[model samples]
Target: MDATMENKMGLPPPYEPAAPNPAPPPSYFGDNPPPPPGFVAPPVAPRTTVITSATTRPGSTKLGPGPTGTTCATCNKSIVTRVEYVPNNRTHIVSAALCVLAGCCCGCIVPYCMRSCKTANHYCPQCKAFVGSHQPS
Candidate 1:
């Protein structure tokens, strides 16, 4: 017999009218309804907070020698950490902009020797310093 005709579940025929569903009571559940007996709300856990410290020398100036905590390599005195940057092209750009603005040469922008030599796995021809791996120009 076909599945539908078999009443495969041994249930009454599918076309048999289901018993009329009785109308549900107007409100099955409501706020502030009295608990039947032993119902109780679970306690809530407190929220947690996390924080991290993220700070470095401002504008990427390397911490180095001289009288004050911040010192200029050229003057051998503390000019200010705000402008002086490590001897790179960027430092030159910054000093050049400063020269244009203030009309003075603040200091020489040192060429990046460490990277050029380290990349070649040889001593720096100019500085004569041994270059190490992992050093970036």
Candidate 2:
């Protein structure tokens, strides 16, 4: 190919280096500032009790024993009670299939009304670790 044709070939342009970014400004508190008169910093809580799980269920004071005193396999800390709503097992799927096949009758909706349709899964809210699951009887 001629020199003009060579230059017109599918070749990328030359690379160019970008300019470096500027450093951030220093903080207002360079090292440590003196505390105000009669002012004292609050004491820090221990790491063990730093995280706590709050129950989301209303009017339900009872908590499952799955997380009580059980050491977390992930965070290596004491497990706390946490309730999570999870889909039911094969029962829900079978019920749904039967409902569809039965022309979605009123009686077919009974499966959806049953309380055993869903289950509760206990997990750590801190690191989102899977602790265990509980199926209602």
Candidate 3:
């Protein structure tokens, strides 16, 4: 190159579109394809699982539990009247709540005899039981 051309602006040669580009046909790529004329979305899933406790349901096969106590797992207000256990996925959730002004009491007590679909970390080593919940206290 000549010295006059060397003293030109610092910009390099403008990029030229290369030949023999391997870009595929339009059928193989996109952000999203055009939907069919009459497309319909799929259904949503149920988040909470079924509760298999007997003390709350006795001979019932309901999904969620009854109630909670005053001394709830959240607050120590001693207001709980019954416990509520909701089976979510593979964990058995334990919730404590309170009855209204009826002065009745409620609490959740796991039978410790039966558990199902335990997570790997929550499974008991000695008894092979599933304690549910990932939080360690």
Q: What overall lDDT goes with each candidate model?
A: 0.41, 0.61, 0.36
Candidate 3 lDDT, tens digit per residue, 78-122? 332332232443233432222233245343333122243222122
Residue-wise lDDT of candidate 2 within 13-71, one digit each (tens)?
54577668868777777688667799988999877657665433322323352444355
| lDDT winner | 2
Please give the lDDT score for candidate 1.
0.41
Alpha-carbon deviation at 13 in model 2, angstroms = 95
Question: Which pairs of residues have clashing backbones in candidate 2?
Answer: none
Worst 10 residues of 1 by lDDT: 114-123
Question: What is the model-wide C-alpha lDDT for candidate 3?
Answer: 0.36
Considering every candidate listed, which one attains the maximal TM-score?
Answer: 2
By summed lDDT, the worst window of 10 consecutive residues in model 2 runs over 56-65
Candidate 1, TM-score vs. the true structure?
0.18
